[model samples]
Target: MSGPVWAPPEPGAVDVHTHVVPPATSFVERLTATDPRWARLVRRADRDDVADVVVAGRLFRTVRRVAYDLDQRHAEQAARGLAGQVLSAMPELFATWAPAAEAADYCRAFNEWLAEQVVGYDGFYCGLGIVPLQDPAVAPELLAEIGRLGLLGVEIPCATPDAPLHDRRFDEFFTEAERLGLLVFMHSVGSVTEFDHAMAGTGAIFPARIGEALAGLIANGVLARHPGLRLLASHGGGGLPASVARLDFVRGMAPPTRESMPEPAATYARRIWFDPLVFDAAVLCLLIELVGTDRLVLGSDYPFLPVDPAELLRDPRLPDGLVDQVRSENPRRLLADAPGTKHEE
Candidate 1:
């Protein structure tokens, strides 16, 4: 909200939000017939560049070579002038509805596979592992293993199984993540079944759900308690930057909200990281105004949305030197500050 105050640095950018679907062969081999609501690769008879991901006996979505082919991804990155990417699992693979044990197994296999990919690719990729939030008891163990596997953090949906993100059920998991200094990437899975029509087609529900989840987290005091936990909200933190004023107004009139929040909701939001994927330069400027430049990182939602990071940084509306921070320095700060890494700052 204030004018950009910090000086910028170099131009190399690190994307903090990118999704990957493991190779279909590996996905099938890891799951047995009894696995719950698993994803299966369906090769199209006619196309070499595309594949459909089938989950629970229905087509989930279509993906391209960029989703699994690192070589192709690298080529795209070179053309776009990106330095690297932080990889997260496809949102559909979350499968939070599955039984806790089964979900944990799926996550383990995925994390192991991701770790292998990160190791093989070395500097090109940073991985965020999945945890079974449906089963809170097993989540801490999974979080621990994610660290052991050399992942910088864990990726979780905006909400858990029985409760929203602010619920007490996830306290232990957040505590452990904070203790371990892991980053928590909050992504939306478009699973709000109540709004079937909205969530079913066009996938417009993701941004709305992301916003609701963020509001829930703030209203429920999760940020207040786990101040040290590093959190990243995808899709420009949904509508949070624009809704801060409304939230502040409501907080003043709402006693429950006031009691739960010791500071302005916008203040807590300012501490969280957000990716600049809103697709509008004006919106991006507002986001920086609301949360400050340091909170933003270059996240293109690569292979899904063909975002041009250089174009965004080159926007004439932005303040001097701000591009350098969002394009490179901010992401480097995030990685350096993550737990279990020698790059602590």
Candidate 2:
């Protein structure tokens, strides 16, 4: 392997990749203005036809969902599957969280509701709170309070094309996040400037656009600036692991070194972590090789991705020890290693 080989996690270890939809966030209530199909579902939580997904293939019921509300889902997860998931966030972050200007109250109410769940629940759940990136200025305090509440982290949307991850002003968010040892999760969203517009027509551009944005986060200095911040990219970190050879000018050479950036191939591969929900082993192997198994963590993209977390966690191709590491150890270390977790050096 190009990087140090890591061990799989022990039973009950930390799972940093699973995504969840806490009841308090009322994620089911918010819909993006761009996707009206989603709007109807928010209004009707348990829709038979309302099975819109927050992640790729996972669907939401008209009934509100709990981490393990579905016995089939739990049976799949309980085999010591992906440690935990980042749940669906409160809907307000999206442009369609509300029909109009009454959104502020909805936002406040949802945050309080989320707090109620995180504070009340135990073992089976962990919280990744939400913040409205539209008002980036207030994000730090939001993150700080979430941390104080002992939530796992905060979830923010992918950077809009108009607002790339490299914007240093957003550093305040990362800065406070770093101070509180909060994790910043980047999931997909809309911007006046989209990284990709499926609405424009056709193409699997989401993966490609994600690659550009995330690579910018690191190669462009976002990671370097907020050294203490911890971030997890959704959807296989979009496609960074797969794009390396292109960066190296190898098999599928890249377009033309967009910026004077480092051969992001090895750099990104080694730094950013990804979830195990990737449906292929060859890609999983390559990610392990490029990013090193240690940086790679187990992610189920649960309540979203259709695959069972256990099966993905135990990918046959991934070495056994490495699978253990991804399941829990790495996440435990990531969070416990954070300055405030009270872990010893």
Tell me how far the alpha carbon of residue 333 in candidate 2 is from the true structure, in angstroms, after superposition.
1.8
Which candidate ranks first by TM-score, i.e. highest? 1
The parts of candidate 2 lying over 4 Å away from their true place are 1-10, 22-64, 67-93, 96-108, 190-205, 242-265, 312-316, 338-345
What's the CA error at residue 339 for candidate 2, in Å?
A: 7.1
Q: What is the alpha-carbon lDDT for the whole of candidate 1?
A: 0.78
Which runs of model 1 end up more than 4 angstroms from their true locations?
A: 1-11, 25-36, 192-203, 254-256, 340-345
Model 1, 1-345: lDDT tens digits are 111111112247888899998876554555636663677667789997988777766666788978987778777775767777888998877888888877888898888888777654436677899998999889988888888877889999887667787888889998999999899999976653354442264257677778888887788888888889899998888777656787788889887787667789898898899988777789888888888889888887777765576577678887778777887888988877765444313
